[model samples]
Target: MSKVSLPRHVHRVVSRGREYFYYQERRGTLHAGERIRLPNDPQTPEFWNAVRQAQGTFGPTPTDTIGALIDAFEVSWATRQRKISKGTQEHYRRYLKPARKAWGDLPARELRPRHVDALIRKIGADKPGAANNILDALKAMVSWANGPVELLTHDPTQGVERFSKGEGHRPWTSQQLAFAEQVFTGTIRRFFFLSRYTGQRISDVVRLSPNDVDDGGFSLPQKKTGVKPWCPIFPELEAEMVTWERRPGPYLLQSSGKSAGKPFSTNQMWKAFDRERKKYSVLSGAVPHGLRANAVIRLRGEGYTALQISDMVGMSVEMVESYSRHADRKASGQAVLREFQERDASQIVKRLESGKRK
Candidate 1:
């Protein structure tokens, strides 16, 4: 069998021509734990659970420490008590690492807003986005710690500010979209249309299957938010679908590679989309995620309210409003222009009436 990548602290040994995996703490480490046998298949969830168990037994951690709180929160996530999508869990883990490294041993009650602020500033000096993510992760962990169990006395992340950043994922312009219609074809074109019409995140879009569609429309339980919204089959999307050859699995599949015919992973889809996007100067600023905002803007232009857009797209009304900012501004400007025009026209009519009276 081919070699498999193993998680940290895990080791593989070949004994009597049989492969076995074990989780062994480093011999020289201060808190060396006993060697525990792990499952043969690392891909299974059981294997991960075993790994978690092994890590848990490594040493005693103070219940009040930040590290203990972090571990508890992670367990909650893994056990689905504080349910979050896998993608979100991964994102949180990435940011939580710095906190775990820096302040894991510190008492949770002792963490202050100043410490949080200082960390943010230190990280913000280099990567503002990462700093903001770290702050978000810290806020979430601190909030959970202060819940019914009350691991913390006060919120350390309270009054801590996120680093200011540009409005993320700029929406594609009509001109750029029009340019895409001429240049883009096949899977890339289909991806553009699905993202442009559904207003779903790329994560959900890649997982979209023919099985999800019904008479009403596509019944999608959104991955990130878990909102099961029925996205209507717009005529534009339907037109594109009619041309597509039916497939057994997902609507979108990898056309070529060792993974060909399998559904595209989110990263793979983004890279493929990006490669196509880079071919034209007009599309340089455009991205796959921007198509979601593009869809929201189009819906707003068609007179859909924020609540209506929220229902259709499974996004919070606040997010719908955020994405529709440009559309809202345009609508507001038009309303103001119409008011001025109507006032001018009314005055003109009054003047004509006065001339007639004279």
Candidate 2:
């Protein structure tokens, strides 16, 4: 085969009587030893476009800046591979946006622990949880850069401590549930019942289908965890869905209107739920997500072990225990109060006997 002279950073090789072009980055870590095949003839627009994509130059050049690293990471995951959920990808973008404005142009290799410390302090002042989440996002990107992308030899966000936030999502009380139930009816009521009974997230609940139900139980793979939760359909949940007059279309919680029977989009459903919730005088600090905590707490109170709750809820044992912490504390306090009551009763009995003898 005759050697074809190619452009710098572009290599040509022939196999099976066809010519192929591959573009490699001359300087970038990800570029080193990586060959990205071009689509067609070198002179065509498609070929250059393919080369640009392979080089990852369609967006900001991911060469040196921390901002570019974030861009590259977004391109790789959000646009190209899409390995994470849309919500998670949006979260990453939200966290990275301010970071990009602050330090995007800074060299990733030059970032030090002190820089991370300063960033954390600055972000933590306004919102501690957000600061922690920012660090987590940066840490994840840095790790990806160091490993797969090969853009960095070292992680910049290493050893950055997460801000101490209290336990997440306060458990919903029975009174709160009752008030919300009284306020919500039909579709919203059914949705709330599904969430509480199944201990699933709102995202999963909105996506539930009739096919997700079975003869004995409700079974479906959770969106965030990918764990298939097979929960025995609670009697209340069964009755709630069975009695509904409107036929369910795509989702179990089908909305009525022009799109009748179709499932509610996550945002549309959440916004609607929120608007109605604000209308009613619901419990403070209670959210739809807290319903999951309520379920976990109720199950724990009913003598279900942490492990059992974890299995039913498709959560880790640690998470189940965490959600049950308030319930556990209440139980413990009651037990201690019982001990004092018993002691006081015995003292009363002794007093009564002495008085009778006198």
For candidate 2, report its TM-score: 0.75
All models: lDDT?
0.82, 0.75
TM-score each candidate. 0.79, 0.75
Report the C-alpha lDDT of model 1 over 99-167, residue by residue, as the tens digit.
988888898778889988998999999999899999999988787777865667788998989877657
Residue-level lDDT of model 2, residues 12-106, one tens digit each, is: 76789888777876735754867787755553334544655676667533347776567567655533333565666777889888788888668
Candidate 1 global TM-score:
0.79
- Model 1 worst lDDT run, 10 consecutive residues: 41-50
Model 2's number of clashes is 1
Residue 185 error, candidate 1, Å: 0.7
**Model 2 stretches with alpha carbons more than 4 Å out:** 1-62, 74-87, 245-259, 354-358
Clashing pairs in 2: 67-104
